[model samples]
Target: MASNVAQFAEGEDPQQMSSDTAALQDQGWALDTDGMGVTKTFHFKSYFKAVAFVNLIAAESSAKKHHPTMTMRIGSVDVHWTTHRPRGLTHKDIDLARHCDRGAGLMGAVESGQGIKCGPKN
Candidate 1:
């Protein structure tokens, strides 16, 4: 059976999600209090790379039908994910986050100072 994020509510007991949150946070994601969202920052060596990454994320967001609030600066990109319809966190948010992480990982992006690359090496 698939897990439903709607089963959880904001400001309620987050014990069940503590571990997941910890893991994601360790990957450089943080919670957005006001938006009830999660955010992650990615640093690139150049402005063009940063913007390209942001564009990649934007394309993915549109494909997923879940959009994140993004801010792209010279050398950094910040992405915040949340469920705008219900106005809080959801499994969709978490799933989308993981997808974003995977996409970043494929591009040789670093998260929390660690380089992440997806897929097994043949």
Candidate 2:
């Protein structure tokens, strides 16, 4: 399991997040900024594949004791990761995002799409 807790000092800068977000994006992960926490979405080819990807993420998140909001759509699975208790993005979030990226690659899913689309209102 990837490390859910990272060495983050207080008052992390948004620019730092941009850099990390870019890195994750390059690896086929979508980053969401229009919320209290960071979100990412991964696309697959079929419902079974999508569910399988979610299961892998579930195991990883459970092992870390950190969870993400997950959604299953036609041929896709969206995962939003953030440290809600603290109300901000953290290294843990980025780490999980990276892990999700790796899982996507392992499953032969290409990360190519528009940036995260805001989910339904509230």
Candidate 3:
């Protein structure tokens, strides 16, 4: 099931954030306390793998024209997505967040707290 099956219109009301956040939560994304963005951290076994995953995220961001704020660690990456133009979350951010999760899975990256059991490729 695609996490971003829903689309939001420009200037959508904040009321929709509840449902949008719920869908993202199921996919491992956490909403910021301010309710303005969603974040997720991906873990890898090596720095090289982490960098490779970041590259995939970059490509996706560029393709969608919706960039995210990223923090790279030795073997992990934190991705925070928010639509800045209108200053809140949007369908684009949700869709890109889902893509990030899918891309991370394909590259053998796992969520930060999931450890080895969550490694989809293993």
Please name the candidate that would achieve the greatest TM-score relative to the true structure: 3
Q: Largest lDDT belongs to which candidate?
A: 3
Tens-digit lDDT track for model 3 on 1-122?
22332333368755675676687789878776566778888888777888888999999899888999999887788898888787777888888988988888888886565433324564
lDDT of 2 by residue, 1-122 (tens): 22332323346667787678667656655445443344556676556677778888999999999899988775677787877656666777888888887887776564545222335533
RMSD of 3: 6.9
The true-structure Cα RMSD of candidate 2 reads: 8.4
TM-score of 3: 0.77
Q: Please write out the lDDT profile of model 1 over residues 60-105, one tens digit for every residue.
A: 7888888888887655677888776655676667777887787766
Candidate 2 Cα outliers beyond 4 Å, as residue runs: 1-18, 28-36, 111-122
lDDT, residue 29, candidate 3: 83
Off by over 4 Å in 1: 1-18, 110-122
Order of quality (TM-score)? 3, 1, 2
Please identify which of the two predictions, 2 or 3, would achieve the higher lDDT against the true structure: 3
lDDT of each: 0.67, 0.67, 0.77
What's each prediction's clash count? 0, 0, 0
Which stretch of 10 consecutive residues in model 1 shows the poorest summed lDDT? Answer: 1-10
Provide TM-scores for the models: 0.70, 0.69, 0.77
